[model samples]
Target: MSSASRRRPWDVHRLPSAEGSTFLVTGGNAGIGYFTAEQLAATGAHVVLGSRDRAKADTAMASIRSRVPDAHLSHLPLDLADLASLKSVADRLDLDHLDAVVHNAGVALDDPPRRETGDGHELMFGTNHLGHFALTQWLAPLLSAAPAGRVVTVGSFAARSERLDLDDLQSTLDYRPKRTYGRSKLAQMSFGFELDRRLRAINSTVLSVVAHPGGALDSLTPSRPPVSVTTAAERLRALPAALLVQGKDAGARPVVRAVLDPEVRGGQLWGPRVFGLRGTPRCEPVPAHMADAEVAARLWAASGELTGTDPDLGFR
Candidate 1:
């Protein structure tokens, strides 16, 4: 695996031009998502930032523009936590076809009291997993035809050790902040692979790929001005941990590769190469949990039931 990775070639500085493609990135206003948007802008793609905060979206766009003066950009007002508003968000997109969507936006709260979204599901599960699941259903029609479009679901390395509690997916039975967040991402990763399976079963052209930004630290991230600023103190603190992780920008590479790589196939997992923690993007093995068809099918049914509406995947 290490030898093949060293032989596999990819240059982060010279991404192929996407030209006319249009991509919508959830939570594109900050962190890894912001860096992903900024990097994609240089490819000449029409990059749209989706978030509930209009002010932050505006700032993120400006930050990208500061570096790439002619970058095409826009914004979509979206609150994934609110399932009721997704259809309207899709309607407002006003595009005949969308080239790609990076499912990177998520909520990871560390505090004690477990929270819930507007729809009354656990906050992390709702916003991180079910929210994207529901949004994908709404966005299905807008995906490009002929050559097919893509959906890159950004998971986390944290999900590797986590498994969904089939009977209590929302952690209603027990909620530990870190574990709950991990399970939510695990659910999201499961959905991505399962969606690919269903799409292939029906011979659909839409591609679904999964990826995770290993360990990304804000302190290691570069300055994006109004969007983000990495302080010197934070950099000093990160020094002790530099070998094990990377900056948010570096972390976004796997997602970018998943989004734009022409040779990449559906169901592939793209992630950091070295130690699966920090390095350039490379294809990695899909962990056992993510590859479990039986479990994923069950989760799919549960998600379809919980989400309360469906778009045509081959199964249903």
Candidate 2:
């Protein structure tokens, strides 16, 4: 493998011109999502920042425009935890063509209290996996209309730590904050690769790929949103991690690579080349559990049932 560097082959600076492409990034209001939008907008892609809060979405677009003065930017309010909100947002998009959708929004709460989404599913699983699943379902037509459009779902390296319980997809059987987060991410990866397989089987042009922002932290991340300021205690906790962590800018590379890298194919997973923590983007191996066909099928069916939205392959 090649060495990671300030200017690797997959560096965002080398990103090809996306002048005519349009990308919608979920959770674009902050963190890795924001940086992904910023980089894409800087590369001349028309970027729509998707968030639950309009104010935050506006602020995020403003921040991006400050750096990329000529950026083509927009915002669409989307609360992934709520199925109704997802439908409303999809209706508003009304796009006939979209180059890509970055499924980056996730429940970022640390040790969040046990909770459920509007539809009564576990919050993390509902938001991270099912929400994107439904959103992708609604937007499949628009994506298929585009020339070689792709869906890049942002997964997590933390997923490698845990296997999912398909029988208890919602974690109702045994709920632990950290473990639930990992399972939700694993579900996201499963859905992404499985979607790719189904799309291929159906001869659909749209592609699905997964990428992870390995070990990126807000503390070391520059241009962080004002609302994202870390407290003293938070900073203290991240001190050790700071040694291995990269900023959001660097972390966003894998995702950007997955989205726009012409050589990349559907079902490929990308992540940091070194230590799976901090480095340039490279095609990484999918976790064994994440690639399980039976698990993916079960999760897909469960997700459709939970969200009340089935995957539409743009078929009539």
Candidate 3:
């Protein structure tokens, strides 16, 4: 809990050499996802950008190519808000194996009054948690095929403030947009930890880890009118606050570290190690309650019911 300068003395400039590896990063077209893809592609890895918008994806890919002329990159359509879209992308993905899968796609719709997705679940919960749940489940075979694959699920410190309501997971009972967003993130974090447990139980080699940008002060969350406007302005006006907010490059560090670091253990949480929630990357501990077995099992069951997908797949 002590706050100190956690900056690594190592040269952060040298790009991660993921040559000979393949990676699929959801929402890799912009913001933190874009930077993550750019860094990975710079290392000669075969990077596929999973994006919902084709035009935006193409633009992001083009921008990356402009910077790193030799970046081995491509784009694939993936809309986390729609299960059908996720299934389609999963079906079309031809990779026999993947070194890492970065579950970076997420949304934070603050429209209020509880909006439901096409799947009829709360928009934020459905897109951020259930979508990734199904996507990861679908990609299990490919991940298992790798020598030692890694699944990096992006979460947020906002999760710390979340208290999952099992009875009304979709926020149907009492939907506060921001609270629901935090709750959904908590679910994602819980899923990451729980998935690691299940993976080990099944004797799978795929490593499951979670990471957060601390408070990057970026637009990682979906924009919704006043809440978005006010939040953005507050973030911008607070320059000292930005000191706690890592840049996209630095923000992407925990994900990279969790995904690529051989020392990273399954179920570990990585984030900045300073106040304002910004600093060099370091492994941190999630709350004990977040890893509660009963809560995870319940959430897993609820997710399966919502998405119509099985959580337990025999992958020994």
Candidate 4:
């Protein structure tokens, strides 16, 4: 068969049944994360939304249930900024095995002199990068035995233009909010790629894949009552940009595809089909700089020490 014909068509609305599986989506209480959980839950998977606030999670879950009456969903109190609490959170998760974990949670300070986490690390890097690093290490046990399991790290298109400065990962010397945030995301994407290689070396069945939403605008997102409200004025104001960007609902496509598409492989980078900004999920080439093994290795080493989890021995 020809290459085009061999490719399986995907319908985001008509997901394959995953009745016996379970998924965890960090920051699943809102935005792209909420839509990710909602779509996965529609497939009959027991999806747990990892959020710092129980009330917000409830609102998001209720919105999801409003759309999917029989959806199996729950909440897990997760505070990525607090490194000490992650273990307890992992222990609290009552599941035999996890089919996938979407590292969709993140923090971005629009403008700041600089901020640090409770752990003394840069806020963005600590929460967005190291937090997920340690969480995955801790979640390894539940993922280890599941051959079809995946770890989907949600990266950012903004990270595409940024580079990592290994010496000042915490931005102690220099910290611009946007730059630091981009670097944090780059670090996370690098970690995802590194983890894929390490998992393969260890003969682990768990696969790692990275994805990014091109440009999802809040104004373009559909209103889901208390969960998300896109006012008419906001929609009208954002109308012109709709041609270039997409909604959080559409932005959720790539990660959802990464989680369930059998054809998607580890080390692959998926993004929007158009200009890496907005469209259906499409498998794309991994940019060379983004896939630099040496840089990822160094970041990996530093991450283990910083998080105090030492993923080398922590991840099963």
What tens digits encode model 4's per-residue C-alpha lDDT throughout 1-316? 9987987589877888888889999999999999999999899999999999999999999999999999999999999999999988657897778889999999999998798899999999999999999999778888885767799999999898999999999999998999999999999999999999998888788899999988999999999999989999999999999899999999999999999998889999999999999999999988887899999999999999998886573555
What's the candidate order when arranged by decreasing lDDT? Answer: 4, 1, 2, 3
* Native-structure RMSD, model 2: 3.7
Model 3 CA deviation exceeding 4 Å by range: 1-11, 219-238
Which wins on TM-score, candidate 2 or candidate 3?
2
Provide the lDDT at 107 for model 4.
95
CA lDDT, every model vs. true structure: 0.90, 0.85, 0.80, 0.92
- Candidate 1, residues 256-283, lDDT tens digits: the string is 9999888789999999999899999999
What are the clash counts of all predictions, listed in order?
0, 0, 0, 0
Off by over 4 Å in 4: 1-8
What tens-digit string does per-residue lDDT give for candidate 3 at 1-316?
A: 3233553443346755778898999989876787778778877899999987888888788877877899888888888878877666656878788888999888877676677788787888999999999888778888899999988999888889788999999888788889999999999999999999999988789989999887775533333222123265554566665655656667887787787766789989988878527777888867887888899989998898888887573245
For model 1 the TM-score comes to: 0.95
lDDT of 2 by residue, 71-149 (tens): 9999887888888766666569877788999999998446757889878989999899888998887787788889988
Q: Clash pairs of candidate 3?
A: none
Which portions of model 1 show Cα errors greater than 4 Å? 1-8, 144-146, 311-316
Clashing pairs in 1: none
lDDT score, candidate 1, position 206:
88
Q: Look at candidate 3 and tell me the lDDT of residue 190.
A: 94
Better of 2 and 3 by lDDT: 2
Root-mean-square deviation of every model: 3.1, 3.7, 5.4, 1.6
Give the winner by lDDT: 2 or 4.
Answer: 4
